[model samples]
Every structure is written in C-alpha cells, then in structure tokens.
Target: MGESLQSIVNLVDPYTLQILVNIGIAIVLALGLNVITGITGQLSLGHAAFMSIGAFTSAVITLRTGLPFSANLLLSGLITAFVGAAIGYPILRLTGDYLAICTLGFAEIVKVVFLNLDITNKALGLSVPPARSPIPMPIIVWVVAILSIIFVCFMKESRFGRALKAIRDDEIAAEAMGINIARYKVQSFAVGSFLAGVGGCLYAHFLSYINPSDFGFLKSVDILSMVVLGGLGSIAGTVFGASILAAAPEFLRFMSQYRMLVYGGLLVFLMVFRPNGLLGGINFTDLVLRAIGRKPATAEVNERHRK
Candidate 1:
C-alpha cells in the first residue's frame, strides 16, 4: 500500500497540480456567478469588480500585515460581499440592458480606481509571498474545491436560496407569497460576488501576481459567459462550461492563427444547438439520481405525464 501510494504521488506533479487548482478556482467563480445571474435573474457585468476587490484585499493583507492565507481569503470574501450588497441595493432595481450598463460602469469605475491607486502600485502587479512549504498545490486545490462544493450545497438548501429560486420562477408570484424580493436579490448578488472575490484571492495566490488590467471587462464577460453557457441554474453545467471555455483556447493552440476563429465558430454553434447548455439547471447530482432510476417528485412526474 505504501509503495502504491508513493507511485500515485509520483504520478502527479506541480504542473498537474496547478491545472487542478485553477479548475477549482474557475468552478468556484462560475458557480457563484450562476447563482445570482442564473437563478436570481440578476445581470451583473461587474463581477470582476468583486474579483479585483478580493485580489487586492488579500494581496494587501498578506503583504502589508503578514496575515495568513486563510484569514486573508475569508476577509476578502466578506469585504467583497459587503460591497456587492451595497451596490446591489440601488442597481438591482434596473432591468435588462440598463442593469447591464450599470454593472459595466461599476466595473470600469473599479478599474479606474485601481489604476490610480498608489497603495496597489498602480499598473505594477503585486508579488505574492510563497505559501508555506511541504503542502502541495493539489492539496490547496482540493481544499478550495471542497469549500466550493460545500458552499453550493448549503446555498441550495438554505432559505435564502429558496427565495432566489422563487424570484427566478416568478417575481410577481414570489412577491405575492410575501418574499422580500429585493432582499433576496441583493443577498444573492452579495453571496455570488463574495464567492467570486474568494476565487480571485485563490487565483492571485496561485499565479503569484495580479494587476488591475487582469480583472478587466473581458474577464467579467468570460465569467458571465460561463454562467450563461452552463445553463441558468445548473451548477454542474456551469463547471463544465467554464472548463471548456477556459481551456478551449489553449487546447486548440495547434490550430495556429486560425485557432481563435474556429473556436469562436464552435462557440456560436454550441449556443445555437444547446441553447440551455450541457446540463443547465440539472447538475451532476441530479444525473446521478436519475441514473439510479429515481424520478422527479410525484406531482411533477404526474404533471408531465398529463401534458
């Protein structure tokens, strides 16, 4: 058993570890954003604002004060959550295109602030201190992954989560049911932004460097695309979508100059065909249950049968 374990350990290296770590970070970010935009029906084109906030907060705390990584990450999420909630109060009332523009402007404002901020060294990237040695990157990745899974599980079960679901189903009906729609909307955005911020902190530590430009409009759009392409309310779909979108460019590098063009074309086709995404709203858990021959609740099954 010892020899087998040693062999298994040898099979995984730092490069593989890094890839795993990045995937965890991506899942955390994509799923969090999906909760708000997909389930709650909010449009936030400024998620990168939360990301930048988290990155800068962790960087500053770790560099200037020598705080532990765990503390910095937690605090980063908290700070970003507060910011998200505060911003959501006024902006969530806007609908559709207006909301998108407002969030877009919020992101630009954040970028501009970071650009001129002296404490962050402006455009110069912050250098992260190395993590305590002996603990491999894969272990950290696993920890982050477990945390993300737990966060999603809890959110799915929580009352606030149910409120978001209600809002998604029908805002008018949810309001009629006495659910405070605005409160839930803001809470969803805050939680989503908090997770995105935490993901950013982890990403910064993984990359060991970050700049204002790194968290630009494209980053926000990329994350938003992951949420949309993954399906509005499906956690597993979001993960799959994020992984494919993030890795496709690199995987197709062999295609040379035309790689991007082909990749873009493929995306268009995917959207056209699988408009709801791979597992939109139906996560791996649901698939597992189905594979075990479980069916939807009796009422739902009966309703479908009647239809």
Candidate 2:
C-alpha cells in the first residue's frame, strides 16, 4: 500500500504536490480554529501566533537538538497548548468583539516579540533541515491532517463536545447545567492551538524556513475564513473550505493585481448569501446515511433525548 501510494505521489507534478501539502496544512489550521471559534464559541484571532510558536520551536529543536521531526512537532504543540491555556484563561472572560480584539492584539504582540528575538534569527528567519525522503513531508502532513480530522470528529460527538455546543448555544444554560465554562473553554483553546502548532511544524519543514512575517494577523484571518467558509462546526466542511481557499490564490494567479480584491469580494458574497457557511450545521455522515435509506443515530432519537 505504501509503495503504491508513493508511486501515485511520484506521478504528480511538484507544483501540484506543493499545493496539496498546503491544503493539508490549511486543513489542520482550519480545523484547529473550528474547535475554538466553531465549537466553543470563542473568538480568537491569534491562531497564527500559536502557529509561529510551533514553527520556531520546531525549527530551533531541529537545528540545536538534532531531534527527530516527530519529537520536535510534539514539543512545539505542547508548548503552544500551554501558551494557549495561559492566554485563554484570562482573556476568555471577555466575549464577542472584545475577545476578538484581545486575540488580535495577542497575535500582534507575538509577531513583534518574534521580530526582535535574536534566537529566532530576528527578521532574517531560520532555515529548517530538509526532509530525508522526497515525498515524506507531504505524506506526514496528510497523515496528521487525517488524524486531526478524525480526532475532531470524535471530539464533536463526545461529552465534552456536547458541553461546548451547549456553551455555544447558551452560556448561561450550559453553566446552569453544571458545565465548567472556564475549564472547557480553556481546554478548547489549548486543543485548537495544539493543532495549529502541529500545522506550523509541518509548514516550517516544508518550506525549510521560519519567519514571524509568515504568521502575521493576515495568516490568522485566512485560517479563520476557512473555518467560517466551510461551516464552523463541521469537520468535513472545514476540509472542503480549506481546500477551496488554499487553491483559490493559485487559480487566481492570472489576475495577480486583483487576486486579493476578488478573494475579499468572494468572502463578502458568501457571508451575505450563506451566512451559516457552506455546510453550516449539516453533517456529511448524516447525509450519507440518509442517502443510504438510514436515519442518523441522533435523528432517530427525540431532540430532547439526544441533547
């Protein structure tokens, strides 16, 4: 199976392969943001900050410790999760646009800090070690992306997931139901940041470079758009959204001068026409089940009972 997969990958052009890897990274970022903004109803615009943390941490570890890429990736994610928890604990008390502002500020702060840090090589950036195999990095990215999607799907159905949904629907009601709002919110933030960090690690290795400019507020906005465009709480929707957005720039390369304008216009159109996002609350699994003449488990039960 591995040999066959490698053979297929080899048949693809390098440019296409690069785009696929980018889509994989975008998927991870979109899903990570989905956990906090989509599921937990938290508004964070500092996701790229976490990604920078992971990318820099992984790059340093690769250069200094000579550790394996897997180890570096894990450490980067752990560190970013810790940072997310620390940040979320205090700022999560704020809600709505205020929370969004704070997170955006946090992203700017992270960018500035990295810009001045000598260890991060300052604005010049650091080059990462090249991958051992020609196709290894993309494969690793795809594997991580798949695992992240599966994990998030399962999480969306778990007890904690329900609590998050409840919180998203009605914070007061969720609290009344004995859900630890603060605890769950922090957990979601941490988990989401962890996934972003993992994506960052992949990105650093793929490009063989790291810089704060690469993870600025614009990057965060791009990731957020993917989650929103895909359908906030839907994993499959996020994947679809990420793929489309990731490929959009390449497809619009011919209109280089108007690319961003077109992209922004498209987003505005989507927001106006499909405010709930492309998939919204619809689950792909439920659709498949219905197509197969079967009811989804949740659909079979009374709404109150399911809740």
Candidate 3:
C-alpha cells in the first residue's frame, strides 16, 4: 500500500507535490501550536524558535554524524523538548500577554544565537541531505503529520487532556480540583515544542537548507494564525486551516504584492465574525457520532439526566 501511494505521489507534478509537502509541514506546525495555545490555553509567540532549534540540530547531526535521518529528527525533538521544559519552568508562571512577550523575546534570542553560530553555518545556512527515495520527503512529512494528529487526538481524550481543559477553563478551579497547574503547563509547553521541533526537522530535510531567517517571528505568527483560524482545541480544524493557509499564497498569485493585505484582511474578518474559530469546540468524533444517529457521550449524558 505504501509503495502504491508513493508511486501515485511520484506521478504528481513537482509544483503540486511541493505544495502538498508544504501543507503537511504547516499542519505539523499548526498542530503543535494548537496544543499550546488551543488546548492548553497558553499564548505563545516563540514556536518558530523551537522549530529553528530542531532544524539546526537535525541539520548538524546529518552533516556530522552517520546517523539515519529518523534518528536525527527524533534527537532534534528530544533536545528541543528539553530546552522548552527549561524555559517553561519559570516562564509558564506568567500568563496572558506577559507570557507572549517573554516567548517572543525567547524567539529573538534563539534567532540571534543561530545567526552567530558557526556550527549552523551562520547566515549562509546549512545544507541538509537530500531524500534517499523519490518520494521520501512527502511521505515522511505526511507520516509525521498523521502521527502528530493522532497523538494530539489521543491526548485530548485522556485524563491529562481533561486536566488541561480544566486549567484552560479556570486555573484556580483546576487547582481546587487537585490538578497540578504548574506541572501540566510545563508539560504542555514541552510537548508542543517537541512537535514543533519535529516539524522543523521535516521542513529542513524537505528544503535541504535552513537558516535563522526561515524561522522568524513572522513564521511563529503564521503558525499561531492557523491554530486560531482553525479553532482552538480542534485537531481536524487545524489541519483544515493549515491546508487553506498553505495553499492560499499559490492561489492568490494574481494579487502579487497585495496578497499579504488580502491575507491580513481575511484574518481580521475571521477574528471579528468567528472569534471562536471555524470549528471551535467541535470535534470530529462528535460529527461522526451525530452522523451515525447517535449522540456523543456528553449529549447522551445530558439527555439521560433530562429524561
């Protein structure tokens, strides 16, 4: 099945395939940010920094070591998670706009450090190894995207997810319910950063080159926008949002220099009209259950109590 899928992908035009690959990467980044800002209700503006960390780490590993590409990606995520945990420990205490400012500052610091680092090849950037197979990159990228979605969905259904929602709803109330806000907040940050790192690895390998400029504050905002537009805590919505945003530039080529203005306008429209996002609080499972003529668990419980 995998071979057949790859063969079909190989038949696609290079431009279209590239767009699909980009969409996959965007989905990964958006999903990661969704975990932090959506599910966990923490505002972050330094996600691109974690991506840079993963990209640089994986690129350096590929250049210096004989390790396989998968190993490089995994190690990059682990290292970035460690860095996120270290940063989150103290910074997570700050909420709302303060946390956003600190995260933005963190991204700048990472960018500057990368700009000066010789190992990262400075502004020149580092060349990543090409994909070994004709369809290796797209396959790898989509695989990671699928895994990220599944991981986040599973987490959303778990006790941990409930705790996250509790904290998101009311930190004080969550604490009263015995949910450890501090530990959960740090964990959410670390996990979100880890996913961002993995996305970075995929991006670096797909492009075969990366630099600090590629993962700037603008990139972080782009990712955050996807999460916001898709609906916080909605994995399926994130994927949809990523697909639209990633492909919008291609479709808006006629606008040329004005495309950004159009993009900004769209965001403003969404914020004003659909502040909760396109699918805010709606899950795919709920849709499935409704389609099957069954109420979701919560709906069923409500009906039962009413009866």
Score each candidate by Cα lDDT.
0.79, 0.89, 0.89
Query: What tens-digit string does per-residue lDDT give for candidate 1 at 46-116?
Result: 88889999988888888888676677778989999999999999999987889999999999999989889
Error of 1 at 199 (Å): 0.3
TM-score of each: 0.87, 0.92, 0.94
The residue-level lDDT of candidate 2 at 13 comes to 99
Deviating ranges (above 4 Å) for candidate 1: 1-11, 132-134, 254-267, 288-307
The local lDDT score (0 to 100) that residue 299 gets in candidate 1 is 40
Error of 2 at 290 (Å): 5.8
Give the worst 10-residue stretch by lDDT in candidate 2.
130-139
- Off by more than 4 A, model 2: 1-8, 131-135, 287-294, 302-307
Give all candidate RMSDs, comma-separated.
Answer: 3.6, 2.6, 2.0
Query: What would the TM-score be for candidate 1 when compared with the true structure?
Result: 0.87
Question: How far does residue 167 in candidate 2 sit from its true spot (Å)?
Answer: 0.9
Per-residue accuracy of model 2 over 1-307 as CA lDDT, tens digit each: 6577778778989999999999999999899999999999998898999999989988888878867677777899999999999999999999999999999999999999999999999999999997443347878899999999888888988998999999999999999999999999999999999998999999999999888999987799889888888888887789999999998889988887886677678779888998888888887567668999998877778665867
By TM-score, the best candidate is: 3
